[model samples]
Target: MKGIQHQLDLAFGENAVTVSRKAIDAGEQNLVLTANTRGAALKVFDGGATETGASKLFGGNLTASVSASVSNTSKAGTDAIHNTLDTNTKLTDLTDVDGNKLGLTAGNVINISGTQNGNAFSASITVKDNSSVSDIMNAMRNLDAFKGATVALDASNGKFVVKGANGQDKDISNLNFNAQKSSTDTTAVASFNKMFGGFTETQKAQDASSDNSLSMQIGANQGQTLAVDINDMGTKALRIQDVDVSTAKGAQSAISVINNAIESVSAERSKLGAYQNRLEHTINNLGTSSENLTASESRIRDVDMAKEMMEFQKNNILSQAAQAMLAQANQQPQGVLQLLR
Candidate 1:
């Protein structure tokens, strides 16, 4: 009986069903309803009661605290060079003591070369015999290399000025200007070299900087909170957990930190929403698959009465034809008996 009970327990309780109960009577021992109730507790526990309870524990609202000591460092960027020509300079003044135009001859070339952000470029302007300074300046302005820089006459100072473009703090120390006369006009080379000697640097490069900071909080659990600090989101560990934003420096730092945190949280929420949608789709697909599989099983197991009846009629007709053929064969044997007589 013990062996039989063991086999029954294995076959019915653990294998064929989620649980099973058995009753046995022994001398002086009555199991009574003990076995029946024994499996009940196991069933309840195994039916996800503990799991459901745990899930409910986390269903409460999440809580979070944010403290930040964000300090946005303001490092200034250096400005590029701004230069002005001598106020009394004139294009026609480029002449030698002989009263002849120096490098200002037709076909004379003026070269402007400079570097911006480590990029080097050179532009050339061919002088027209009687072109004025304005015409020469216009030609230089049209060069691709000079497009990013400004070239204009400072009317207030009566000086020609060349400066870095607006908002660009480019270094201009490497910028240079030179003039070369046509080979035939060798007398003007020295005069052309002296023309650019009048340029004076008016402004030195200076750098600019800005600072920012902020503080915020996010929920982690019901009545519980996780602290977050927002620092430069571009930094490693992309979180600001312990920053203090009460002081001026802290407040400045918190600005960028808070902005980054907001972006991070928004992205996380978007990811969670995407995951939730994916899970819902997965559940729907599973349900549809289960339904389709169930239908297939039903079709495989179920009998079609109309088709079965047709098959039965076909077999019955075949049986009748076989019986008639057997009877005809037996009659032929009897006819042989008659001939023998």
Candidate 2:
């Protein structure tokens, strides 16, 4: 949404219209684009095509329910998409979806297999007596499969979520977890399926709305434009929107969520800053090119006074020599007539 608004501001003046997200009900999320004044139909010229502000902001043809406020212009999501796992969970002292603690002891090995971003992933995590919930999350995060994904516990429910690091929907599937006894373990361990298998995808992964993304002209030539994809920056997108700070354990779980959100925002800001720098460099290069072109045009069209003066001097000297020779030839003709007389 910020990205959309930025492009709109570049196309139109800043604050010509206001774009915002509103919740009509618990199940749906929508965007609202309102003109500051009546009869101000917000619009923008993207590349060669002219697009209405609503379509550019929401992507594609919008079936908006218009009112005095211009509410529900587009659907962002029904709710933030995420996969949830129990909170304050440790491998050594495992708790299932229910309140029952399992007989999982130290040295129990949990194996995980999943498809992340359309790639197969497998990893085994060893449980230690001192390992906390964070350890498990770290293990998942460290896996190559979850490189562009975030694994963090929810602050409110102590349940963790796995989501796109950039607050976008990710393709992840067949995430299976099961436990076995380690080489040194002798005691009969509780079934890992009851605990780990209960990990549910609470929300479905929804792709970000690309149709709303407008390609802005950033360079002079054709196709020198940028289409900035607007990623969701909501807490639900980060899987930390429902965090609870009322209890100590909840607060502890919330720590990872808060940190993850902070890190995500920081990374996003860095990316935008880098983009700004690239634009600045492009402007400088364009300016330099314009200056060089002007110099070339002057050389082609402008006259050189010094060279013209030198040519004039050379022509005058040659004309003077020719006249002197003509005068001497006339004298020779007169001398020949006097001899004949």
Identify the candidate with maximal lDDT.
2
lDDT, residue 45, candidate 2: 20
Off by over 4 Å in 2: 1-89, 96-99, 167-170, 183-190, 198-341
Error of 1 at 318 (Å): 67
TM-score, prediction 1: 0.29
**C-alpha lDDT score of every prediction, in listed order:** 0.45, 0.57
Candidate 2: lDDT over CA atoms? 0.57
Candidate 1: tens digits of C-alpha lDDT, residues 192-301: 56535334333223221111111111222343222222333443334345344666655554555556567777786776676567656657866888899999888866
Clashing pairs in 2: 59-211, 59-212, 87-158, 155-244, 156-243, 156-244
Q: What TM-score would each prediction reach against the true structure? A: 0.29, 0.33
Q: Mind giving the per-residue lDDT tens digits that candidate 2 earns over 1-341? A: 77767654443234435677667678755565654321234432222333322221102223222322232222321112112234444555554322235556777877777776677887877778876668777778888757666677765434456765444556677776667787555343545554455454422243222343435667778767665545677865565545666767556545655776788788888877877887788789889999999998888655676678789999999999999999999999899999999
List ranges where model 1 is wrong by over 4 Å. 1-103, 155-158, 183-188, 197-341
For the record, the alpha-carbon RMSD of candidate 2 to the native fold, in angstroms, is 21.9
Worst ten in a row by lDDT for model 2: 75-84
Point to the candidate with the largest TM-score: 2
